[model samples]
Target: MLDKKRIDCFTCRHFYITWDRDFRKGCRAMGFKCNEMPSIVVYQNSGVECLRYEPKLPRKQK
Candidate 1:
């Protein structure tokens, strides 16, 4: 069994939803877009946790 780290791309600041239908998600920090989540792609490629995973800041309501 392959061990997978639990990384949530949506919580990272680099994660962004794209307008493209095929590749809906992208990572600004890595400068790439993919159908899979950025963190998952990074982990699969590098076999390690993402180095640029920065947590998104809480939005302040006006």
Candidate 2:
């Protein structure tokens, strides 16, 4: 089940925050924004979990 290992958009590289209040959340890979997490939006629209999930790289501590 998708719920077993949830795809967290916050940890994904493609995840982003948009200026639009209605669609503040976004996915770069999918090129879309939404109120909820991008993964949830993808699942809602496509009836399948997001396939473009890539884990975000750790930022260097400068």
Candidate 3:
């Protein structure tokens, strides 16, 4: 059995929630906004995992 890695846009630093009512999510790295999560959209269009996935940094508490 092959192990599959989960690709979540929420985990990426480039991922961001949008204010647009039509497109709710976006990827800064990819330079496009979409209605669905960027990771899923990219995978569906490209048939591969996101190449620009960068782990989101932990928020600093003041």
Model 3 CA lDDT for position 57: 96
Candidate-wise lDDT, in order: 0.88, 0.88, 0.87
RMSD of 1: 1.7
In the range 1-62, model 2's lDDT, one tens digit per residue, is 35656799999999999999788999989998889888887877888989999999999999
Off by over 4 Å in 1: 1-5
Model 1 per-residue lDDT at 1: 15
What is candidate 3's TM-score against the reference?
Answer: 0.85
Q: How do the residues 1-62 of candidate 3 rate in per-residue lDDT, one tens digit apiece?
A: 11377688889999999999888899999999999778878888988878999999999999
Once superposed on the true structure, which residue ranges of model 2 sit more than 4 Å away at CA? none
